[model samples]
Target: MWTAIAGGIQYIIDMGASVMLPIFVAILSIIVGVKPGKAIRSGLILGVGFVGLSLIVNLMNDQLGPAAEAMSQRFGLSLSIVDIGWPGMSPITWASELAIIAIPLAIAINVVMLLTKLTRVVNIDIWNIWHMAFTGVMAYAVTGNIWIGVLGTAVHAVIAYKLGDLMAPMMVDYYELDGLTVPHGTSSYLAPVAAVVDFIIDKIPGLNKIDFNADTLQEKVGVLGEPVVIGFILGAAIGFLGGYAPDQALPLGINMSAVMVLMPKVVKCIMDGLMPLSERAKKIMNEKFSGESFYIGMDPAILLGDSQVVTAGLIFIPITLLIAVLVPGNRVLPFADLATIGFFIAGAVAVHKGNLFRTLISGILIMTLTIWIANQTVDWVTAIGVTTGSIQAGSVIAALDQGGCPISYVFTQLFTMQNVTGLVVIGVLYAICMVFYVNLSKKRAAALEAEDDEE
Candidate 1:
């Protein structure tokens, strides 16, 4: 019976996010009192949005993946092990034995936290439960203890929900995404690096005053500074650096420009579907909980539609490679993740209020830290990949997403006792960043509330 249950859950997960999320959204909407017809319509719109996003992301992956590989080869980056990114990591995660139970386990934890008032985030982003599952399976792999693995999943979920709570106000104020919060993926785990960077920048005088974004560039150069033009130029430059001639580079440039133009249009579809559900959920929760506010946890992809995020993602293509070369003992070449590097820095852009200069500084720290951690986790990730047959025997793989997540790394090391000093350093540093992040988030939340009062 247990085996059958697990298998059933695995089958649902195997259906892919584009299908899985739509079903989840439709069900959740119906539960919140939306009419079945409207709920189904909303779900289909979300599905359409996901399909659009998939097309753009696949286009990005197809064009940039080879270009990135060529750039690494041209520069002799000497980085050996491949970083598979989420596309590869997701399948490996869902194939794990722990993944079957992780969805229910994470949901249970979220329920407990909500009831106990430990967190205000209603994390319905079921597809991203894989992040928590990845951490658990890694810990289980390292220590050979199923209990410890479960504990790791619990801990990661708790932190992820709290991260959702903390970032909610900023999500509303900056991204204008009211009633939603991102509590999944590297965006949640790595946001503390941005918080810490924001704190330090505040201490400096002239540096703190620096601000730039796509709008600033547009103001300076008129049409030439626009996102489409900027995307084309950056894309063509990347292709040229990847050793492509002008003839080939120009088409890549045009496609990237299309990506810039099209991403937000699809996101609008998602928002249109979500708005009614969000309003209904808010109304129901407020009535049930005596006017308490709650945020619906979601994936970080929503933030990718912002122009600043797209521009930063483009700039980081080269900057991340440069950082990879500079970081000592880094072996995982930045390839697969180069396409959607925006996800990593999306929250930082919000925390910095879209100041591109500050985002660049924090992004440097975030990617460098991510690369270092991915370098550390290659063996563990490769073990899972081989077990899932996602890669051949003796293949080494890592990812800048969950594979490099510090929550998994720190939790696993705590049990395995393999690099006590590294654990202590990262553990303490991350703890400090959490302190700053909590304080920063509280201020933002309070400010948001005050604005609400005025309105």
Candidate 2:
């Protein structure tokens, strides 16, 4: 019976996020009081949006991934281990035994937290549960204990939901994404570092006044300030730097410009599907709990449609590679993940209020730290890759997304004790960042409440 059940769940996951997410969403919507017809329509729309997003992301990876590799080669950045990135890493995660139980485990944890008032986030982005599963898989790899791995998965899920709560105010204010929060993936986990950086910058005199966002550039430069134009320029520039001829470079520019334009339209489709459900959820929650509010946790991809995020992602493609070279003894070259670097810093951009200048500062730190962690975890990631046949027996692969995740790294290290010094340093720094992050969120929530009162 258990084998049959596990096989059934694995089958559904194997269908990929574009299909799995919609089916889950449609069912969840009906459970949450949406009409059946509307629920089905909503699910289909969300699926279409995800399919559109996948196509755009694939276009980005197909075009930009090679350009990044070429640029790395041109510069003799002899980073040996390849970062297969989330697209590759996610499949390896699903192939694990831990994955079959992770979805249900994470959902159960969310329910327990919600019932106990420990968290206010309802994470319906079931596809992203893989991130939590990846954590468990890493712990299992380190200790060879399945139960310990399950604990790691549960701990990660708990932190993820709380992260959703911590960033909700900023998401509402900056992205204008009301009642929606991102609890999924690297975006939320690495965001605390930005909060810490933002706090220090706030204390600095001249730095505190720096506000160079996408809108500011648009206002100053007229036509050239537009996101599409900026995307074209950055794309072509990266291609040229990568040693591409004018013909290929110019087409890369056009493709990036298309991404800048099409991202929001497809994201709007996702929002169209989400809003009815979000609104209904809010209504139900308020009525049941007497004015209490909650957030629907979602994927960070939704945050990437903003012009600031799109422009920042383009700028970081080359910047991330440079950082990879600078990090001491770093072996993982920033490839597959470079195409969508925005996911790494979308929360930072929101926390910094769309200030590109601040995002650049924090983004550098984020990538540098991610690379350092990715370097440490290459063996474990590579092992998992091999076990799942995602890679050959001896192939060394890493991913910056979950491979470099702090929670995963810290948790696994606690059990292994293989790198005690690393554990101490990262554990302490991440703890400090969390403190600042929580304080920042509280202040933002208070400010928003005050504005509501004023209205």
> Which candidate tops lDDT?
2
* Superposed model 1: Cα runs more than 4 Å off: none
Off by over 4 Å in 2: none
lDDT of each: 0.88, 0.92
Model 2 over residues 280-353: C-alpha lDDT tens digits?
89899888877888999998989988999999999999999999999999989989899989999999999999
Worst 10 residues of 1 by lDDT: 382-391
Alpha-carbon RMSD to native, per candidate: 1.2, 0.9
- Mind giving the per-residue lDDT tens digits that candidate 1 earns over 1-455? 98898877777789888888889889999998999999999989988888999999999999988888888888888998778899889888888787777899999999999999999898878999999989988887776778887898899999999999988988998999888999989877888889999999999999988888999989998998899998899899899999999998899899889989999998888777777688898898899999999998987888889999999998999899999999999889988888999999998999999999999999999998899888888888887777656779976788988877888889988887778987998889889989999999999989988998999
Candidate 2, residue 251: Cα displacement in angstroms equals: 0.8
* TM-score: model 1 vs. ground truth: 0.98
